[model samples]
Target chain A: MRILKFLLVKEFKQIFRNKAILVVIMVMPVIQLIILPLATNFEVKNIALAVVDNDHSDYSRALISKITSSGYFRLSGYCNSYNEALVLVEQDKSDLILQIPPHFESVLLRENSERLFIAVNAINGVKAGLGSGYINEIIQQYNQQLRSKLQVPGKFNLGPTIQIQSSNWYNPNLNYQLFMVPGIMALLVTIVGGFLSALNIVKEKEAGTIEQINVSPVKKYHFVLGKLIPFWILGNVVFTLGLLVAFCIYGIVPLGSLITLYTFVMVYLLAILGFGLLISTFCDTQQQAMLIMFFFIMIFILMGGLFTSIDSMPDWAKMAAKFNPVSYFIAVMRMVIIKGSGLYDIRGHLLTVLGFAIVLNAGAIVNYRKTF
Target chain B: MHSVIVSHLTKIYGKEKKVAVDDVSFSVDKGEIFGLIGADGAGKTTIFRVLTTLLLPDGGSASVGGLDVVKDFEQIRQTIGYMPGKFSLYQDLTVEENLSFFATLFGTTVAENYELIKDIYVQIAPFKNRRAGKLSGGMKQKLALCCALIHKPNVLFLDEPTTGVDPVSRKEFWEMLKRLKEQDITILLSTTYMDEANLCDRIALIQEGKILSIDTPANIIKSYPDVLFAVKATNMHQLLQQLLRYPERLSSYAFGEFAHFSFKGTPDTDGLVTYLEQHGLKEVMVKTADITIEDSFIKLLG
Candidate 1:
């Protein structure tokens, strides 16, 4: 108990003394919560457009007006020729370009023409694809209107005859925050759990106080536990803070029980912190720890499904992710928040995390055992 | 009575190739100040770590206060105080906080054993609220000593405690150890500083994972088996070369301003003066030099 007290006081003092921890634990999550969601989105907006309208007809003007009026794009300039439109696009002044033929209305009226030039920037591939699809849908609507005037059979239908029903589970509105908050919570915990704990332990080793503890009456397990427990609790606090901020700011309420979420969080924290302790055992300096942690954080964020789905990965990578504790935690958080999954739904994840906690920690203890 | 004892202690590190502590064995009597004096990587810290129960020797056994370091590691830890070479107190914590934390860890309060560390503690007690990381090297050293002694352990292991500290603080720290000795607690210290060997009741001079000699400082110096002389001349570097060329010289090493040399036979000052003059050496003076532990170390290495 005294060892525990001593370690806790020391850990708390270190957290306050070091502004780096404050920045990572407190400020970063908030900034990422607010800014990342706003910046990193699949939804495309504010597309700059250039038009090459050689037809000089009412129909082309109306089509250009329709494309520009959707609030998704702005008409940046009117090019006199296709070359000017191409130049604008190559210069990065416009993201998309539309070209009309010299006899656009005449050709449409004479032979029901089809080839139309729609150039879009593929640098942002997903955005370009979605924007082009949106434009295609608008032009299809315009064609339907023209067909109605021409008295085409089965035209001008307000709705499809084959009806399809859609339903959303858990978060029925499909709020982006509802999907992101839990992952953010898991990510925040990992940064605190994996990086901070490793650096903290390795720093003590570098400073030589580790020798003091080695010689003290404190058992190796006691010293390791003393260090791990405080950081583990701090990880929980940061996780909870992330949860609360996500809820208050974005209305991203968890569908599962808070107790259940925090329970898995607690178990997940052990595996993460154990991994950090294992890293500290192998590393001699804080700089080395930091470099290794940078790699860990990158792997955690990428494979943990923060921005991509692990299921989409190749067979080997997907199998490898099974042992990743970050993946399990992120999966559990998503299951609990988005699917309203009960404890039974996440039992497999819990067992995996528990296995990791036991095995990794045992490995760390064995590797660091002080047999000279 | 022996407070610390070991038998044929050996530690080999890699695949049966490297021996960090090879067949090393020594004992420290109760209430005595013993030193393991050696240069860096001479296995002093390894010996200290093994004795403190932080490490288990590969092929030998050690007992402190009659408790085996391996079998009774928990009890051994409870009985010893260790100050590692590096300044390793919780840098974020204030001086008072670091003291209290370590004191509480040993199940004692600082107030209970204030007398044990009062002299060193009082020096930095005025700035008790200052963070340990922000304090000077000397203050950190004093605080580390206070922390180590807070528990009032039966034995203390200080591993190269004054390696980077300034000379004055080093002097003060040794004086503090002298006072601690009067309290009748066994102290096992390690240092690379040869001058500090004199301060210990007995020192084991070690090099290359082997103990060259272990004895009282006076006895170790007394056992110099050669006529040692310090030679100085106008050409200091040339004078060293000239002294080494003499056929009767055993060993000659530059010590401070003069080159200390050992003789193989009778003192031949007149013959040496004639040889130096022939070598164009001016103001040649030869005197008996005090053999330091460093000289003894170099000779033992040779």
Candidate 2:
């Protein structure tokens, strides 16, 4: 234990002495937290729309104005014919084109019905899907307005018989930044802790300092722990800074207990940093460690359920995600921050992380060969 | 009891299938300066690493202070101080921090073993605040030695500690080692410099991962089989070529300003002088030379 204190002091001193890595740890994460949340938003807005009116009637004009006034679409082109609207879409001036049939108002008054055609550019799938959905909602709202104007309560009732009154429970606004920031914070923590600790023992190996340590009476567990705790503490520190960024920039605070959040981060870091030392033990050079670390981290980030929903993934990837420790932490982050989930809610997640921490660390210490 | 003992130690690098140390054996008496003298790749460092518990031998056994290197590895580690071939002190750390860290690692304080490293550490005391990376080669060597000795282990293993050091610093380093020897600390060091071999109480000459011969410097010189003659001509390179072509010449090599020549049959200086003059070589000289360790080593290589 006394020897471990000295090792910790020496490790910390080395970390603090390297100015470039220090900046990468403490400052780079803050900048990434600010930029990634804002840049990686999923909410697509400001779709361009083109309109064709065969009957320039009040109904047509009202519908046009209403769609424009919804602030979701902009009037990019006005086509005199269906062919012209097709041209507008072809020319990339519009994402959606709404075509009203001839005698549209007369048909509505005479037969109490009308038909309209919508052409959407489906090259960019997400934009096309969301854009057409918004147009359909506007048409439905226009039909209700026409019905209400036609009569008082006895004559006409156009309101839906059963209303949804849909309210997004946790994230009322559906702010993508709020959803994305915590996961990005998890990624930065992984990078800082894993990258640094991955190079720790390998660095000593390259410098030949490991020979001196191997000949000394230092226990393998003491050496592994001495390398682990410093980075684990720094990982939490980086996590705290990320949380502060989330609060100051995105106004996101964990609705769950802060104590529970920190407690899980502590366990989460052990599995990650211990995995780093595991890589350190297997590699002979820092470059090899970095390459292997890069490979694992790339897989972890892509399959971590940070960007794509795990539920949407195919069966095989879901099975693989079960093995990814980042997936558990990301779920923990979302559950605690957005759902206000308590510790009991995350009991299963805690068990998995605890298991991972024990297994990865045990593997690292066992593989750390005392002799060359 | 001997501070270190080895019997038929063998180590093979599994990947390359190269034998790094092959069936070598030696022993170091307590408090003696035992030098393993060889060029680079002579397995000197490999032996040091194995005995220090930094490496395991594939065959045979070794012990430090009567403790088996394999079974009592932890105990061996506690009793051995190792300074590897490379300057392995933390380059980013201050001199004092590196020393204290090593001292504390062995469950001792630098203050507790201050006397053991005092002679070496005092030279580096003024630079205690400087980063070790910025020190000169000699200063780094001294600092490494100080860190190794801070725990005051029973035996010291230094692998080519003077390989890259400057001349003045190398002399100072040997002086420090001589002082440590007086305190009855068993010192085992390896060096490629043949000149440095004479300073050891006993030395082992090794090459190609095998021990060629092991004895005191004077005894190895006395064991040279034939009398050596130093020959010189005005044109030295051509003279060496000419000496090799001489019918009676068994072997010839350039050493400094003279060509070392030996004859298979009994030599006559008058006969050799007549041959050199007939070959039109001017300013010819030949004199009987005292055999040094290097001469014996070259002769033994044959």
Candidate 3:
């Protein structure tokens, strides 16, 4: 116990004295929490649209006004011919083209239907898909208005209409930042905890100081715990700072009990820190440790259900996500912060992370050799 | 009572399985200053590493303080103090912090063993607050020594502790070891400097993972088998060339301002001078030279 105390003091002093580590610990949470969430928004807006209106009729003009007023698109060009509108798309000036054939209003009234052509630039698939979907929805609504005006509403009722009274339970406003902040907090904590502890022992190896430690009477578990406790505290500090950034910038607060959230965080940190120490034992230099940790961290973040939903992934990817500790933390963070989940709700996640902490730490202690 | 003992210890490295320490054996009695003298890559460090419990011997067996190196390594680690060839203390930590850390790591306080490290610690006490990396090479050596000695272990292993230190510091370091020896701490140290070999009570001259000879400094010199001579002339390089061609020459090497030469049979100083002058070398001089440890080392290598 005395040995562990001294080791912790030494590790903390060295960590705080290193300007590079201090900078990383302080700057990473702020940048990841504040800037990344705002930049990673998937909501597509401001699509440039070109209109080829050969009809020049009242109905066609009304449709154009409706599309522009919907605020999903900006009218970038107005042309007399379809070829002219095609030129706008080719020049990258427009993302979509809406063409109304001649006699559009007359045909719709006389024959009950008219053809409208929409040409989308499919280079950015998501933008094109969403842009086309929005336009289609608007045209359907306009067609409904025309049908009701042309017929008597009481005589010709359009069957029974079923409306979806959809209400978002957790986040009513559908704010993207609220959904992203907790996951980003999980990512930030993983980065700070994983990288710092991974580099800790390897730095001693490069400096030749580990040999001194190895020859001492200090037990392996004592040394491992010494390395773990300091970085664990630092990980908590980074996490708290992330929470502050989340609240101050995005006006997000944990809906659940703070004690329950902290319980999960404490266990998750142990699992990640244990993983870092395991990598440290296999590496002889800081560069090796950094590269190995980077490789694992990249995989962890991508498959972690942070930016992508796990349910939508392929079978192999879902399997990978199932094994990822980061995914569990992201899940728990969202559940506790947004869903107001209690300990009973996150019991399974908490137990899995606790298992990770035990297995990884045991592996690290076993692999760490006092002799070569 | 032997504090450290090895019999035919071997260490093979890497997939290539190159022999690093080959069939080497030696022993150090209690409280004696034993040195392993060799140049770099002579396996001095490897031997030190094996005995310190940082490495396991590939073959044979070794023990420290009557504990087996491979089986009883845990107890061995507790009783040994090791300072690697490279300065191995935490460079970002202050000197005092490093000392205190090692002290506490051994489950003791600095105040508990203050008497053991007092002589050396006093020298570095003024710079206790300065980070170790900023210290000079000599100061770094001293600080490393202090950290190693903080626990006052039964055996101390120092690997090239004075390799890059200045002359004055190296001299002072040896003096500190002498004082440490009086405290009844068994010391096992390695050095590449031949002069430092004399300071050890006994040394094993090693090369290429093998021991060439093992004896006290005076005894090793006394056992030299040939009368050696130092030869000099106006054209020293040409003189060396001519001396090598001498049929009776046993060994020849350039040492400082003169070339040390030995004969196959007996001292033929006059004949050698005449032979050198006949070869057109000018102002030739020859004198019988004292056989230092270096000369004995060269003789033994032959």
Candidate 4:
């Protein structure tokens, strides 16, 4: 017990003395949390639209004005023919094109129906899909207005109309930042904990100080705990900083109990730091440890449901996500922060992370040898 | 009583299993300073590593403080203070922190064993707040010695402690070891410097993982088998060549300003000088030389 105290003091002193580490711990979280959410937005906006109007009738102009006023698109060009609009799309000036055929207004007025053409540049799949969907919704609204004017006092009531109204729960605004802030906080905490502990022991190995420790009377558990506790505390600090950034900049506050969130974060930090120490035990140099950690962390982040939904992934990737500790933390963070979950809600996630902590730390202690 | 014991100890390295320490055996008595003298790659560090519980010996058995190196390694680790061939302290840590860290690691404090390391610590005490990496080579050696002695273990294993140190620091380090011996702590240190061998109570000459000889310095010199001569001339390089061609030449090597030469038969100082002059060598000089540990080491290498 006494040995562990001295070891912790030495570790903390070394960590603070290293200016590079201090920067990584204090500055990296703030920068990454603020910038990553604003940059990785999923909502597509400011789509450029080109209109080819063969019909210059009042109804045709009304439809064009409606599409532009929806705030999802900008009217980039007004061409007289489909060929002219195609040129605009080819020049990358427009993302979508709308073509109204000749006599479109007369046909709609006489036969009560007319067909419009929409050509989308399919190179950027997300932009193309969302842009076309927005245009279709606006045209349908125009048709409803025309039908009401032409209906002879809603004769026969169109055989009982059924209108379905759906509202988004948890996040009524569908604000992307609200969804991203919690996951980003989880990711930042993971990075700080794993990288710092991974490099800690290997630095000693490179400096040849481990030989002195190996020959001394310090027990294996004492040394491993000495390395673990300091970084664990630092991980909590980074997580707290992430929360402050979320509340101040993004105007987001957790709806759930703070106790539940911290409880999960505490266990999650243990599991990740244990994994880092395990890697440190297997490596002889800092470069090797960094490379191995990079490889694993990349996989974890991509599959952690941070940027991409785990539900949309392939079957094999989804299987891998089930075992990822980062995924569980992200899920718990979103649950507690956005949904106001209690301790009982995250019980399963808490237990799995606890298992990870026990297994990885045990492996690290066993692999750390006092003698060759 | 023996403080350290080894018999037929062997250590092989890597997939090729190259032999590093082969069938080597030695012992050190309590309160004695034992030195392993050899050049680089002579397995001096390997032996130190095995006895300090940092490596496992493949073939033979060894013990420290009457504890088996393999079975009672934990106990051996508790009783041994090892300073590896490399300077292994935390370079980013200050000298004082390093000293206290190692002391607490061994379940003791620097104040508890102040008497043991005071002589060495006081020399580096002024630099207590300075980072170890910023210290000079000599000061670094002193700080490493202090950390190793902070716990006052039963035996101390120092591997090439004075390899890159200055002359004055090396001399002072040997004096510190002498004082340590008076405290009844057994010392086993290795060095590449042949002159340092004379200061130890007993010295073993090692090469290529083999022991050439083990004895007191005076006794090893007294056991020289031939009368050696120091030969010098204006053209020293040519003088060596001419001496090697002499019919009675046993062995010849350049030593400092002269060539140390021995004969196959009896003393032939006059004949050697005449032979050198006949070979067009100028200002030839010859005299019988006293055999030092280096000369004896060279003779044993034969």
Highest DockQ, which number? 3
The per-model DockQ list reads 0.63, 0.73, 0.83, 0.79
lDDT of candidate 3 at residue A18, scale 0 to 100: 97
* CAPRI grade, predicted model 3: high
Off by over 4 Å in 4: A79-91, A149-152, A156-162, A370-372, B233-250, B263-290
Against the native chain B, each candidate's TM-score is 0.97, 0.97, 0.98, 0.98
Q: List the residue pairs that clash in candidate 3.
A: none
Worst 10 residues of 1 chain A by lDDT: A155-164
What is the Cα-based lDDT of residue B254 in candidate 4? Answer: 96
Error of 1 at A222 (Å): 2.3
lDDT of 3 by residue, A39-91 (tens): 99988888999999989999999999999999999999999888998899999
In candidate 2, which residue ranges exceed 4 Å CA deviation?
A: A48-65, A74-123, A143-162, A370-372, B233-244, B268-284
**Model 3 lDDT, full chain set:** 0.91
> In TM-score terms, which candidate is top?
3
Docking class of 4: medium
Interface RMSD of each: 1.9, 1.0, 1.0, 1.0
Task: Quote the B-chain TM-score, candidate 3.
Answer: 0.98
